[model samples]
Target: MKKKVWLSIKGKQQTQDQEAEIIELLTEGELYNKDKSQYILYKESEVSGMEGTTTTVKIEGDQVTIIRLGTTNSHLVFKKGKKKYNRYETPYGDLLMSISTKNVDVEYNEEKDPIAIHLDYNMEIDGAHGSRNTLDIQVKH
Candidate 1:
């Protein structure tokens, strides 16, 4: 049962001594539940700098997965106290990416569907340390 939804996605990234960089996007997406997991799907617009791309987010307990297709391609996973690896593909080049998750917090609705999610992690790209990052997503009716 997929339902239309509005998403507020916010992210912040900070290097060792650099100022935190932030991005916020408000977009319409679809939401559904299946196989004990919840999914959110949306298309990336030019404002997000990934036009023509579609993003899907899956949430199950404290683990979250984000997949992107089209202009960019990537599979990123986040689980508290775990490190996940993947390749991020782009027109320029593909990079080896790794995510070390420090925390995952989720807020759920009465139906056990997630209404909000927050993740804290560190990222490495091409074997080089990148940034300490946070991603927050809020779902609106």
Candidate 2:
């Protein structure tokens, strides 16, 4: 089945335009799947004036690994980081965001709506100073 995932980031100190830009970045990328029923969707955004990158990688496996890194450009700034973006977060105090919607313990709920995968994201604006944000997402099949 084809899957579509949506991501959104919100913060108190972020501007409306910045929020929109983040959303755009999240939805701009495509989900990567190495096997059927298992996939990964990654999204990232940079806070203007803030030198950092935030990336989210949704892995379908039971255990997911999140790594944060530091980058000088946006998520799409280059093609090399595109795939590795999920493995590490840029050192820019960016949070690695991801959600696993595949539940094997319970049967699929056909009547219920897709659940929103919420992730707490924290990033440092400067060395020690930073802000906290929430990433709300939904994965649909």
Candidate 3:
């Protein structure tokens, strides 16, 4: 079933908080359960500067992965208390980035499917502390 998705992100750095939000249709989304793990697939529209890009999110077990492809290419993996590194490709160039997840919270629907996800993490780029971040995703059928 297709659903409406609302995403909100907040970043805190140097005592300042910056927030951004997007509300869009979920192009492709599904939830799967197997063994002791659950998986989610979510895709959304291309954004402004990210012209040809498609944003895809996958959640499995306690890890969340986000990928952007087309105009820009990047992969980010967030696992609680673990730091993961990756390179972000942009029009300008490539950027080295690291993400350390602090917490992950999930809310489920009556069907045992995920209806919301909340993540708290810290990010660093090129070895410098970037921001503490919070991302919330909610879906409605």
Which candidate achieves the best lDDT against the true structure?
Answer: 1
- Give RMSD to native, each candidate: 1.0, 10.2, 4.3
Error of 3 at 61 (Å): 0.7
**lDDT tens string, model 3, 1-141?**
433444433233331354533333434455555555555544434433466676666677788787888878999888888999999999899999988889987787897667787888888889874777777666554
Q: List the candidate 3 regions with Cα displacement exceeding 4 Å.
A: 1-48
Where in model 1 is the C-alpha error above 4 Å? none
lDDT of 3 at 75: 95
lDDT of each: 0.92, 0.36, 0.68
Give the clashing pairs for model 2: 56-97, 67-89, 68-89, 69-89, 69-90, 69-91, 70-90, 70-91
The full ranking of all candidates by TM-score, starting with the best, is: 1, 3, 2
Model 1 CA lDDT for position 93 = 90
Please, what are the lDDT tens digits per residue for candidate 2 over residues 1-141?
Answer: 434655443423342335422432234423444553333344444443333543444344332333323463333211111222222234444444322222212112364323344444333332333344444444443
Model 1 Cα lDDT, one tens digit per residue, 106-128: 99889777789899999999988
TM-score of 3: 0.71
Backbone clash total, candidate 2: 8
Error of 1 at 99 (Å): 0.2
